[model samples]
Each structure stands twice: as C-alpha cells, then as structure tokens.
Target chain A: MKNKGLLLVVSAPSGCGKGTILGEILKDDSFYYSISATTRAPREGEQDGVNYHFITKEEFEQRIAQGGMLEYAQYCGNYYGTPKKEVEQMRDAGRDVILEIEVEGAMKVRALCPDAVFLFIAPPSVEELRRRLNKRGTEAAEVIEERVSQAARELSYADRYDYIIVNGELEKAIQDFRTVVRAEKLRTKNGNKIDEVLNHA
Target chain B: MKNKGLLLVVSAPSGCGKGTILGEILKDDSFYYSISATTRAPREGEQDGVNYHFITKEEFEQRIAQGGMLEYAQYCGNYYGTPKKEVEQMRDAGRDVILEIEVEGAMKVRALCPDAVFLFIAPPSVEELRRRLNKRGTEAAEVIEERVSQAARELSYADRYDYIIVNGELEKAIQDFRTVVRAEKLRTKNGNKIDEVLNHA
Candidate 1:
C-alpha cells in the first residue's frame, strides 16, 4: 500500500528565518510546495503555476463562493488564498505538501485540516529578530518596530503548534525541519505499510 | 536552561532485532540504559548496577510497596522491575533513558508517563521474524512456535504506540529510532529552551 502524504503547516513571525529554512528544504524535490492563488497579475518571468496561480478576480470570488479556497485574504484589493483541490490532490498522490503562511492563515488551515502537522519557526532571540529585520532594510524604522511587536504577539501562539524550531543556525534549523517530516512519516497512522507487507508475506 | 531528557519506552516482539538496533544506538554513549532490579542471583562477571541491580526478594518487595518500581513482573520465583529513581535522575540530568521492555510493560509505562515517547519496532514480515528466531538456534522447535504466535499477538498492539519502526535493515531501523527521539525533543512542550533564550535576550 502506498503511504499518504503529510500536510505540513509552517508558520513563523516576520524575520524569523522561516523563508530561508524553507528555501533550503524545498531544494530537495521530494516535497510539493503549495502555490497560492492570487488575483494579482503575474510578474515578469513568473510561470502561472510555478510561482503563483494567477486567476481573475471573478474566478477567485467564485472559488470562494464554492468553498474551493482553503483560506483567503484580501490585500490591496486582491484576493490571495490556498486552493484546496490542488493540495488535496497532491496529498492523495503521496506527495508531502507544505503551506507557509502567517499565524492567522495557519489558524485557518488548522480549522480546515486538523491532522496537518503545524510547525512554528522562531528566532533564537527577540534581539536577534530585531537585528534581522533591521538588516533587511526593506521597511522604515517605524515599520520595523511594528513588525517586532507583531512578532511578540505571534510568538505567544507558538505553544499551540505541534513543534517549535528555533532558527539559531541555518543548517541546524533546516535539518530539524527535515527531521520533523521524516519522523512524522513514521507515525503509526502513516506506517500502515508494515501491515500490508506482513500480511502479504 | 537545560533541556530535560526524554523518557523512551521501546517495545518489540521477540526476534524483531530490537536488541541489535539498540546496541548500535547505545554505542554513542549519549543514552543511559535503565537497569532492571532483579531478585535473581547475578551470573559471573555481572556487576551490580551495570548489568542488573541485584537485590534481595525482600528489598524488591519493599520497593514495590513503596511504588519505586516503574513496572515489575514475577517469573520462576524472581522479581524483575525498573527502578524509577534512577530513570528519573537520568532524565532530569538531560540524559535520555531507554526502557526496553515487552508489550505489557510498555503499556504500564504509557499509563505512568504519558509524555514519554513510545516506539514499537517490528520485523519486515512475519516470515522474516520466524527466520530470525530460527537463526538464533537457542530455542527448541516448540518454543520457537510459541514465540512466533506471541509475536503475532504483540504486533496487534503496534498501532497503540506513538511511533512504529519496521526493522527491515539494521542501519535504517536505528536511524528511524534516533529520528523519533530527535523529533520528540523538539516538541513544543519540551523545547522550552527557546523561551529562555528569547526572554533573556
């Protein structure tokens, strides 16, 4: 019997290095990254399905009406959400799917699929987080302060997650994330292949 | 803050290669093996506290009355059980303690320490298990048959375990066991070191 894929919901506060850790993990082709469906126009050199599933506003609204969107949010008059069908299909095909989102979106996914493994990535320290945000130089000082406060609030929810990995070092953090996926596959619920092998023998 | 050691309850049917797997894992010196206190006389070269904690029957009974034994059983007029204080001390010192027991003892540990990680190791197939038992050449034919039947009954309880590892290849089985321990330590309830670092920073 083929093993079913695991749905992993990864959440982290801003500047917690979740993106870097995920980028390293996705370098291996074993995982299927869940692409977000957006009403925004595709950028230059971005493929429709590879980067984001570009959809019309009317189509996005229709998907929401039909309950096709797992979770969605409107930002700058554009709809961004995860398509439930694609995720389900990938999982059914025995391909592990990773959905990287913020705390609120992760909460939504938790409601939709309670069995999904929820992991919260955290920075080694709040001071370190503040340093990373400042190093990015993408936001103004006031915006960075707001992000730091927002991160503290998000960290409060870390206890609700199934696993918490502190991004102290890049390589160690990536390895820890991979370990979570590997160990979860060995759970009794997912390791039923043993039964089939034994019975057939 | 130091991370607390994990209590690991490992169970496997006879001839499942759990002994071999654990031998390889303990060679690293990272784990403290839980020594069993026994009323039986120690064989030559079996030092106290190293092999078995040789104790008098009266002492064993007193410990049992005091609830010092994590789990105990009687066979051939001898008492054999785990000493809870030693296991707790090892874990409190950030050293993982492994309790290698049979299915019934594992169930007892589960009731006493629900937070401990319970792992069930299985053979690749029933045929493979029978082959391994025969290869040992220590048991009579009738005894081997009894062991095989017992193994079948024990396999039924694998689903009750938190993790099940099929001991197909020796190296792979050891790797899976280590992965379970590593992943369990990262669980949010035990990963409080993250909180200390964040707060102090």
Candidate 2:
C-alpha cells in the first residue's frame, strides 16, 4: 500500500552519543534530516543550509509569528526551529524526515503530529552517562554535575517516547534504529488499500 | 531491563504462504510455537502433543467449560482451540509465543490479550492468491473458486492487523517477519526500567 513518509522526532540527553548514532543513520539517502533554521552564528567550517539554515533574528521571529516554525526554542539568546513547510513537503514526497530536537521541542512536535515516531536514545546507566560526559573533558566538574542532574530529568521522559534504544553498543543501536523505521512504515500503511487486492479479484 | 515475553497473534489467508513464513520464523529458539488442542482424530504420521494435543470430545468440552481454552472453533463436527495455560506459562518464562490462528480466532485472542502483536500475511494480489491456490492442483475447479472467494473475505480483515506483510518475494517476506519481531520486542519494553539508570545515582 502506498503511504506518506514518516515524521521522526528523536531526543536524547546531552551525553548519550545521540549525535554519533544520528550521523550514522543520516548517511542513507532516503532520509531528509530536518535542518534547523537558527539565529546562532555559523561556526568555523559550518555551511549555511547544510549545517544550519542561518537566519536573522527578524526572520526567525517572523516565521515563529507566522506559525511556519513547527517547534522553536530560545537557547543562549538564539532561536532554533524546524521549518514547518519543508518537513511537510519532504514527507508528502514520500521521504522520511528526521527531527533531532530536545525534549520540550519533541513534546511540541508530538502535539502537532500525533502519528510522528518518537525515538529516545538512552545511556546504559546514569553513572555511565556521567562517565561519558566527564570523558569529553570539555566541562568543569561543577558543570558535569549540573549536566548529570539535567540528564536525569531528561531520562524521566524516556517513557513517553514510542521507542527507547539503550545505546550499549553502537552497531546494535544503529541496527535497532533501522528495524524501527522498517516496522513503522509497515504499521502506518493506509487501510483503504484493502481495495487494491479486492479490485484485482 | 526485564520485561515479559510477547504473545504474537498471526493470521493469514490460505495460499498466502503463512505456514512457510512461520516455519522460517519458528527456527529461532527464542520463540515457542503454540500447539493447539483438538478433539479431531489425528491424521497420518501426526503425533500427540507434537502436531496437536489430541483429546477426547469430553475433555475438550471440559476445558472449554473451565475457561481453559483461549479461543475455540468447531469445524467438521470436531473441536479445536488454543490451550490457555501453556501459552501463559511460556510467556511468563520470558519466551515469545506465536499463535498462528485464523482471522476469527485471532480477534478472540485480541480481546483476551489486547497487547498481543497481530500480524497479517497477504499475497501481492488477489490474482496471485488465486494462482497459488490453483497451483496445488489437488482441488477441483469449484473448490478452488470457493477457496479464492474465502481468501478474499479473509483479506478484508487484514486492515485490522497491526502489521501486514505482502509476500511478493519469499526471502524478503521472511526478512520482514524478522524485522517486525525485533521492532516489537523493542517496543514492548516496560517503562519502569528507567529506575535502573536512576538507581545508580
């Protein structure tokens, strides 16, 4: 049966290796990873449209005002959001669109698209999460403690997502993610296609 | 995270290659293929408790009256049904159980165990179904035509299933069956395991 593509909302706490897992998943051409239009300045070697859809504060607020942003949040005095039109367009064209966002934004997207697949990547344990964060060596001990607390809060919301992949091993997590995509596509087919076989009779 | 095993309720119209697909699936030791109980006389080369639990009419009626049968159907003046106790025992032991029942029996299991995964196997087309039914060359033209009509009726119920696999290529259909099993196991995890991580803190 022919059906529209999936809208996938993915969330993971800061130190859960979500970026690496998602980066591996996006290598497939069938997925159109939703690029957030942000007011943040592009970092060195980051291309506009490829890394982030760089936009002015005026345009960011204007899109939010016009309801063109699917979900947006103000972080570090910068606006970041998924463009509503692009995500819908990609799905309409039978292309899966992945939205990588934090928990609050994911909840917002859930309300807007009830059928969207919600995926949460989780570390094996809170201690493991702290170890990963500390190993990064980019945060002070106090900052790491704060992040661990924030991560506990995020992990609390893991129950609400449709599927949770405990990232114990990288390869298994990637394979599990692909299994979800295949199973969801099979689940989401339009029932009206029962007519296809009946018509052939 | 610890969780109970899944009870998978599978239904497919005759000639849709359901037995072949399920035979491939049951090769994995993690699954306990459900053997039904019947009052009918055993066919050639059939063994008790292997092919089915062949019981007397009195015993079958006793089980039904005691609510021991999960779902039962009367066919050709004999009784056939799924024995409820063994299925529950296997599932409680963390072993996935497969119930390969027909459409009506599948619905009864659905009402009894609402969380049981429902899978429907479908052919590529009704014409293909007719072709496969006729290919057996054992039935008469009238019987074959009746079977095709019966198949169409069963296909109408395919929409009620949680997932549908259109068996076009044999290998791909088997792979899809495995995919659904993996994805469903991922989906059916108990959320209370979030404490596993939080407790480490």
- The number of the candidate with the highest DockQ is 1
Which segments of model 1 are wrong by more than 4 Å? A40-47, A56-62, A74-78, A197-199, B197-199
Kindly list the per-residue Cα lDDT of model 2 for residues A1-201, writing each as its tens digit.
446779989999998889999889989988989999999999999999999999999999999899999999999999999999999999888788999998989999989888798898888888999999999999999999999999889988887888888887899989999999998877725332455434464
Q: Which ten-residue region of model 1 chain B has the weakest summed lDDT?
A: B192-201
lDDT of 1 by residue, A1-201 (tens): 567789999999989888888898888776889999999998899999888999999999999999999999989999999999999998888888999888889998888897799899989888889999999889999999999999999998888788989888999999999999999998876655447536445
Worst 10 residues of 2 chain A by lDDT: A188-197
Q: What is each candidate's fraction of native interface contacts (fnat)?
A: 0.54, 0.47
Quote the positional error of residue A26 for candidate 1 in Å: 1.7
Off by over 4 Å in 2: A40-47, A56-62, A188-201, B188-193, B196-201
Alpha carbon lDDT at B91, candidate 2 = 84
**What are the lDDT figures for the candidates, one per model?**
0.88, 0.86
